[model samples]
Target: MKTIGYQEVREKLLAGEEIAIVDLREEHIFAQNHPLFASNISLSRLEIEIYNRIPRLDTPIVIYDDGDGRVERAYTKLREYCYSNIAVLDGGVAAWQRDGGELFIDVNSASKAFGEFVEHHKGTPSLSAEELKAKIDAQENIVILDARRFDEYQTMSIPTGMSVPGAELVLRAPSLIKDENTQIIVNCAGRTRSIIGTQSLINANLPHEIFALRNGTIGWTLAGQPLEHGQQRSFSDLDTQIDEQVKQNAAQLAKRAGVKQINFIDLQNLQAQQDKTTYIFDVRTEQEYEAGHLPASRWVAGGQLVQETDHYAAVRGARIVLVDDQLVRAYMTGSWLAQMNWNVYVLADDFAQVLVETGGWKPATPQIDVDLFISPDELQQLSTTQNIVIWDFTTAANYKKGHIPHAQWVLKADVSKLIQQPAFTSLDAIVVTCGSSLLAQYAVPEIKTQLKSGQKVYILKGGNAAWAQAGLPLSQELELLSEEIDRYKRPYEGTDISKKAMQAYLDWEFGLVNQLKNDGTHGFFVI
Candidate 1:
C-alpha cells in the first residue's frame, strides 16, 4: 500500500496498462537522471498541474524522490486530495537503476527515444545538413518545411523554410505543391520533430520525395550553414480541405498503427469510464484550433504534443483522443501516438461539437484566493520593514535577471526546511512572488501552515512581472534560500548555445536508439 516495486511499474509500462511515473523533484535535477517514463511533476505545482495531467484519480500512479525526503510530502498531499491509487516508488530511483533500469539524462526521454527507434527500424530517409545546403545552393526544386511549432519556426529556421508543423503536411502540403517534381524537406530545431514529421509524410504515401533535414537546424548550423531569424513563412490555411485520397492514405497509416476511430457516442462512452483517464485534444494548428474546434478538448499542436508528451500528458497509459476538423490531421497524429504505446483515437467530425470557446489555448490553472493578494505598490509600502521576508519562487535565471528588492530565491518544496532557519523563523510576514504569481499563490496555503500564529503570508499580485511593469526598482542581488534547479536548459533551444553543446545534443540523440534497445520497456514500433 505504501510503495510499488520498480519491476511492477515496469511491467505496467511494458504491458501498456494505465500508469503514471511521477518524479517529484525540481525539473533540472530530474533532467540529470530518472526512469525513461518518469514525468517530473514537482510537489510545488502538483495541485495546480494534476487536474489535467493524471485526470483519473484512481489511475495507477507511482511517485519517487532521490533520497531527498520529498516523496513523503508528495504522498501526504496526494492523500489529502483523495487520490486513491497512488504509491511511492519502492527504494526510490536508485533501486530502479540498481535493478538494471536505465535513467535517461533528458526530458521527454521516452518520446525522443521512440523517435530514434522509429528512425532505426523504419529506415526513415534523411538528407544531411551539408546535402540540404548544396540543394539550396543550386536552387533545387524543393520546399523546406519547418515542422516545429509556429513560434519556434519564427525564432530561427533553415533558409527559405516554411512552417508546416506536424500533421499539417498531410493536411495542406498537397494543395501547396504545384507539381510532382518538388522535393520536401522537414526540419525541427533538432532531431525528433524533423524525424517524426518526415516519417508522417512518408507513411501517408506522399508522391513527393521527402527527407528529414538531418539533425535539423542544429545540424544546419554545425555544417556551417546560416539560419534565418524572424521568418514568418507559414502556409497553414483553415479553408483548405483535405483531398479524399489524402484522407484515405492518412487513415490507412492510422489503421496500420492500430489507432481507433471514434464517433461522438464512442467518445462519450470512453469519457464516462470512471476507471479510465481520457484526454481529449485538438491536435490541429493554433490557427485552426482558434478559428473553430470541438468544445471541451485541450489544444496542443500535433507535432508538439508528440514531441513533448510528458509535458502535455503525464499519464502514460491513459486513452488519448485527438481531434481535427480536417480529420486527416488527427489520423496522422493519432497514428504516431498509437505507436508510442498510447491508446489513441482519431475522432470523427460528425459530432455537433460546436466551436463554443473560440480563442487561443486556455490552460486550466491553479485557483488563486484574491484575499491573499497584495499589489506591488503595497509590497513597496512594506519594503522598509526588516520584518518582511520576501521569498521568490521564480526560476534562478529570472531571479538573477531581476526580482523584488531583498527577495530571497526559494524552491517551493524547500519552504518547510527554509522557515526553520534562524533568518526566516523571526520574520513578521512572508511574501511569496514568482513571474506571474500563479506559482506563488499555490505556495501561499502551504506556507501558511509553517507560519507562527501571529505571522502572515501573502502573494505579490501579478508577481515580479507586475513589479517591473509598475516601474518599481528591482534588486539584482541574489539571496539564496535553496539551490536553483527549477529549469533544465536544453542544448538545442535558444540562440545562445555554443557549437559544442549543439553537437553534444545531436550526439546524445544519435545514441538514443541503442539506449532504447537496452532499456526495452518502451513498446514503440513504426508502421
Candidate 2:
C-alpha cells in the first residue's frame, strides 16, 4: 500500500487541503491517543460508515494504526470498495509522536479544542457552580438553560434548569426569557456545549447577563450541589416576529464567523463538484428530522454536529452545509464549524417542502451472500428445538433497551476475546444480529473464522428490529459479555454517578487546553 509520512499529513492539514486521516482502530483504543485531526473509523465498520462520512470516493484518505496490523487490513478493504486515493501513515502513532505531532484523547477533540480556543480568545464568561447555587438560594431571577439533548437534560439537570438544547438556544431562548435583566445561565454535562451555547447567545446580542455554568453538571457535583433528576422543562413555541428576529440575528452571527449563506442553486452546483467533498446535514432535533428533512440530508442535531464534527463529517476541509427551518440552528452550528476551520455554509432558503422521508432511518444492508442465514421465524423455531448462541452487535444502550429474548450483547472489537470464554466454546450454532442486520452481515465473515469446523454461524436476517417488527417478544435483561466502554459515559447521561467520577471528568477536560497547546496542529480560530 502507498504510505505517507507524518510531516506530509501535518502540512496538508495546516495548508487546509482536503484529507481524511482515519484511525483504523476500535473507538476505545482510538480515544487513548490520536492525531488532532484524525477521525476513528474502525476496520469492522469501515464499509458501513465510510461512504456516508467521506462522500467523495476520491478524497485523499490516510489510514493509521498504533503498531497494530489493522491499517493494512483497512487499506485492503478500502481498495476492494473502490476508494481511489488511499494511503497508510508511514509509522502510525509512534511515528506521529516522534515527529512532534499532538495526541488528543477522547472522541470529538476538534470540538473540545474549539471550545477551549473560544474561552481563551473571547474570555467567555462563566459562573462557578457554587456561585450559581448561591444565586439559586437567593431566589435570583435567572434562567438556567441546559444546552444538552432533551434526553440528557431529562437524566440530570441543575435545579430549575430548562431544556433549550444546543442550536435551539439561539432560536428558542428569546421566547423563554421575559425579563431582559434576568441572568441567563447555559450548561451541559461538561464544558463544550455550555461554552458554545453561552457564546451563541452573546454573539446574537441578547440583552441579559449570560454565563456558562463553569464545567457544567460536573462542576455542580464537584461544588457539592445536588442535581435534579428527570426534569422535563422544554421551550415553548415563539411568535412569527420573534422567530424572524432570531433568523436575522443568526444570519449576522454566521456572517461574522465567515459562514457562507448558500442558495439551493449554489448547493446544486456544490454537489456537482466531483473532486471536492460536500456533506449536507439536517441540523434539527431528531423528532423534527424524522418528521421531514431535505433529500440526502443526514439527520444530526445542530448541537451534536458542532460537538462531534469529526464523527459526522470525516473528510477534513470538506464543504459542509447545515439545514434547518428557522435558519437559526443552521447558522448557529455553521458559525462554530467556520471557527473550527471547516468550509461551512448555512442554507439560506425555505425548502421544507423538499423533505422526502418521514420516519426512522433504515440503512440498506450490504449484499453479502453468507453461507448460513436464517429468517426471524426460522430462528424462533430453531430456538425451541436446539441450542443456538445469539449475539447482538447493536450498541450497549440499545441492547439494554430491548433485544431478542435470549440474545447476548457483544462488542465487535472483543469478538476474538469473547470466543475464548467457556460458554462460547461448546456452541453448536452462532447467530449474529444488529439494529438492522447490516452490521451483523458485515461481521459474519470475521465470526466464521473463529468457529469450530463442525459449528455453524448464521446472520439473523433483518436483526432485532425485524424481530420486533414481527411482534416477537423482546427482553430488557442485560446479558453482556464485553464491557460497554466502547462509548464514553457522560456525567449527565444517567443519575447516581458519584462525585468522584464527576470531579475526574472535570479534571480531564481542564487538561485538554494543555493537550491542544502541546499538539499545535489544530487550526482553530476564534471570531
Candidate 3:
C-alpha cells in the first residue's frame, strides 16, 4: 500500500472530493480539534465495533491520528476483512494541518453531536444536572440512571441516578424507566460511553425515549452540580434484564467475532478429522467447567475470554471452539473473537450427546486446581519483588493510561516475538497481566518454553489492577500514550516486513493523496 501526505489530502478535499476523514485519537484530543469532515473512533472502541459499523468488505477508507500509526493497523484490519482500498494519512493530523486543512475545535467533538442527535430524534429521553435537581426539588416523574461501573457511580452521582453500566443498559432500561411517561436519562463519567449507552438502546430498537445525560457527569461537575455518596441499591427486575442482555449480547458478539456454533453431529466430526488442528475451550466460569465439561477442553471463563484468548491460543492458525451451555456467554465471547478475526466456534444443543458418543479423549495433564489461582494482593507482592519481571500483556493504550510501576508491555498476540528481543533473553522471571489474571495464568507455560533453555517463571495473581488497588506505588507512563495504538510494527506474514513496515508506515503518512481519496463514512465519531 502507498502512503499519502497532508498537502495531498487537503488538495483532494479542496477539489470538492467526497471523503470520510477519520480521526483515530483519544476522545479528549479529538474533542479539541479535527478536520471538518472527520469523525472520532478511538482505538479501543474500534476493536469492538469495526465490523458492526462498517459491514461493507471493500469500503474505501482513510484513518489517521495525531501523527501516530493507528491508521496503519486499522488499514491492516480492513485488509483482513478483504478490504483492499484502505490507506493511512502520512504524518497523521499534523501532516493534514501542515497542508492547511481546516480544523474544528470544541470541548467535545463529533461524539457529542451524535449524542445530541440521539436526543433530537427518537424523542431520546434525557435529564440534565439542573433538570435532575429541579425534579429532585419538585418530586417530578424522572428517573436517573448512572450507566457506569457501580464503584464509579457510587463515588459520585446525581441524587437519584442508580448505577447501571453501559453493558446493562438494554436489560435494565424497561424496569428503570418503567412508566413510559416518566423521563429516563442515562449518564456516564464522560461522553463516549454515555453516548454509546444511549445509542445501544436506539440500536436495539428500545421503545422508551432514552437519552444520555449530555456530556455525562463531567459536564455535570463543570456545571457545579452536587453529588451524594454511599447509597446502596437492591437487585431489581432490571438486574434480570441486564443478565439476559449480557448473555444475548455475548452470543451475538461471539458470532460477529467469528466463533462458530457447531451442532452435536458436527462436534463429533471435529474429533474424527485428525488432520485439522483444533482446541476446545470451555468458556464458562471454572465451576461450570468442573461440574462436567468436554473431557479435555481448556478452561477460560467467558468474561475473561477476550483478554485471555491470545494467551491460550498462541498459534495463529489454530481453530478454537468455545463450549458453554449458556448460548449467551458463548455468543458474547465469540463476538469479540470474531472482530479480532479469530476462527472460533460455539457448541449446539446436542453438544453433550456429541461428547458422549465420541468416548472422550484423555487429558494431557491434570485439571488446574481452581483454588490455587493466586489472589490480586499476592500477585502485586510478587510483581514488586526485583526477581519477578511482569510482562504486562495489555493493550498499549490501557498500559499508558496507568500500570504497575515496573511492568513492561508485550502485545498479547505478539509475545513470541519478545523472545528474540535482547532484553527478554536476560529476564530471570516473567509475569503476565491483561484485563484480568486469566491471561497471566495461560502465559506462564508459554514464556518458560520461549526463554533461553531454562528460566524461573511466575505470574502476578490478579495482574496490575490488583497491584493498583493494593496501594502499591504506581507509575503513569504518559509518554507511551503517544505510540500508535493500531500498528504493532510487526513484519508482514512469512517474511520480515521491518523495512516494508516502515514503508507502509511512511506510505500511510506520505500517501495523504491516496487517503483523502479513500476516506468517507458519514456517521462516525469517537467517544
Candidate 4:
C-alpha cells in the first residue's frame, strides 16, 4: 500500500483511470460532496460488506477520509486482505481545494454547479418553483416527484407532488411518469437524494432527461413556495384488496417453506400454559423498533435472523414466533428458520399490537421448507435497487476477508445486539447470506418474526464464496470483528467451533422457556 497525494488522484480521475474512489464516512457526510465516481462504504460496516459487494482482488481502489484516522485503519485492513492496489487521498478533499482545484458545489457545498449543469446540458431536465407553480396553475404536463419517505410526503409537500421513496424509485418510476415526454422533477427534504435520484435515472438510460428539483423542498420553501400539510390519504380500496392478497400470498409462501401460522391469543395461552421455553423474535429493523415493537421481543432483522439464531435463541427445541407487518418477511424468514429444527410460526392476528405490547411470542407450529434457494447474482441484482440489509452469518474472519458490499456486520457476540439500533429497524428489505446458505436457511422462520411492519426478507442465493467466484467487487482486507472476537483469538487459539456443538447448543437453549416463565419473562427469548 502507498499513500498518494490529492493531485495524483485528481489527475488519475481526469485521465479516466478505472479507479474506485471509496468514501469511508458516515452516510450523511458522504452524501455531501463525494466525487462523481466515488461510492459509499462506511468503514464501520466494512467487515460484513466487503465480500458480497466487492469480491475482486485486482480492482484499483483509493479511499479518502475527512482527515480522520479511519483512512489509516482502512489502509491496514485492505492490505491485510491482500487487495492488489490501494492508496489514500493525500490531504483529503480540503487538500484538493488548497491545490486550487475547483470544487463541485453540490447542495451541501452551496455552489451553483447544479444550476450550471442544467444550463449547459440544455437536455438536463429541470423545473423551477416558478415553473412548477405556473404548470400547477395551468394544469399542464408535469409530475412532481417527492422522493422522500411516505411519512414525510404526508407531512408536507407541493399539492401536486407524489410520494416516491428513493429505493422504490426504480420499481415505481414507470408508474409515476407515464409519457416519455412528461417532464419529471425529483425532490427530497434536501438535495442529496434528489440529485442521486435524477442521476440514477440518467444512469439507467431513461429517455427523459432528469433533473433534481434544485435543493428539494427546502429550496422550494426558501423560494416562497407555499407548502401543503396534512396530506395523509388512505391506501386505495384496491390497496385493501392488495393487502389481503399479500396476506394470502404470504400464507402460501409460509406453507411452501413449511412455516405454520398461529393467532396472538393462542400464542399468549401457550406462553401461559406451556412449560417449555419458547423464543420470540421481532424481525423489524432497528428504526422500526424505536417507532414501536413487541415488548421483551429480541430484535433481529428478518434477513439476519437465520444467521444469528444461535446468538439469541440457539436451542433447536425453542418455540420461535415470527412477527412482521405483513407475512412477507415472516414467511420468508420462517422458511429459512424452519430448517434449523425449531418450532416456528407466523403470527396471523394482532400483529401490530403484539409487536407494540409484548414485543413478540414463540409459535407452536413447526416449519419445513421443501423448495427454497437463492443465487448470489440474484441477491446482487436485488441489492442494486433496494435498501437491502444483508447479513453474512459466517465466521468473522471470512467476513473480514470478503463479504457482501455495504452489509452491516454482527459477529457471534455482537449478533445479539443487531436489533438494538435505529438504522437496523428502518430497513425496507433484508437478505442473509453466509459462506454457505445453510445457516441462513435454517434460521429464517424465527428471524422473520422480528421484522419491522413492512420489510421484505430474503436469503442470498449464493453465499460469499459464490459471490467471490462471480467476479464482483470484493474488498482485499481483513479486520478483527470486535474486541471479543479479537480477544478470544490468542495467537494459538483456533477459529473452528464444531458444527455439532453449534447445533446442540441451539437445541439445548430451549431450556430458557421454563426459566423465562418462572421469572415472569414468558415472552422473552434469547435472540
RMSD of each: 2.5, 2.8, 13.7, 25.6
Candidate 4 error regions (>4 Å)? 27-40, 66-68, 103-119, 123-131, 134-155, 164-216, 229-527
Please, what are the lDDT tens digits per residue for candidate 4 over residues 1-527?
Answer: 47777667656644434455676765456645554335555565454444323434455677887875678777776776666678787777777557654433121221122222222333435566676677789976667776555666777777777765553343345556658787677876544456545644553345565667765565566567777776753111112222344345445645755678888887777566434445567665455555666665656665345533433442224467876664655665665456434568877786556656533332221233624455778877777777767766665656777777776544332333454467768777767667765555444543465777887667766667778888878763443333322212211012233434333332322232332223221121111
lDDT (tens digit, per residue) of candidate 3 on 1-527: 65777666555544534334556665556645576455565543454334323333344456776654556656665565565556677767666666666454432222333334333343545556576567678987766777655666666676777876554455556666657687667776655456556655655545556667765655565567766676555223233444564455555644444567787667668856644445677765455566677765766654334433433443333456777675654654454454434566788775565333232223232123233345556665655564656667666767777887767766443454555567777665666666565544544544556767555666566667777777766677532312343333222111223443434432332333233334332222211
lDDT of 1 by residue, 1-527 (tens): 47888788888888878888999998999998899888899986776677678877788889988878888888887777768888888888789988888879989888898889889998989999989989999999999988888888888999999988887877888876658999999999989998998898888888989999989989888888889999878885334656889899998889889999988788889988898889999987677678877766888888888888988788878889998877887898899899998889988855445555678766565455547678998988886764898989888988999888889998889887777777767788998889988777777777777788888888898999999999999888889978778888888887888999998888898899888877888888777
Q: Which of 1 and 3 is the better model by lDDT?
A: 1
Give lDDT per model, in order: 0.84, 0.83, 0.54, 0.55
In terms of lDDT, the best-performing candidate is: 1
Number of backbone-clashing residue pairs for each candidate, in the order shown: 0, 0, 36, 54
Query: What tens digits encode model 2's per-residue C-alpha lDDT throughout 1-527?
Result: 89999889888887888999998887878888888888888865776788888778889999987665677777776776778899989888888889888777778888887887788789999999899999999998899999988888888899999988798898877778768778899999989999999999998888789999999988887777899988778884344235676678878888888999888889989999898998999888788888887777888888988998899888888999998877888989988899888889888776765666788554322356676779899999988877788989888889999999889988776675677677766778889999877787776776777777687888888888889889999999888987775566655457678877777666777777788788776777877
lDDT of predicted model 1? 0.84
Model 2 misplacement above 4 A: 236-243, 350-353, 361-367, 370-373, 400-402, 413-428, 448-456, 468-485, 496-498
By TM-score, the better pick of 1 and 4 is 1
- What range of 10 consecutive residues in model 4 has the weakest lDDT sum? 486-495
Instruction: Show pairs that collide, candidate 2.
Output: none
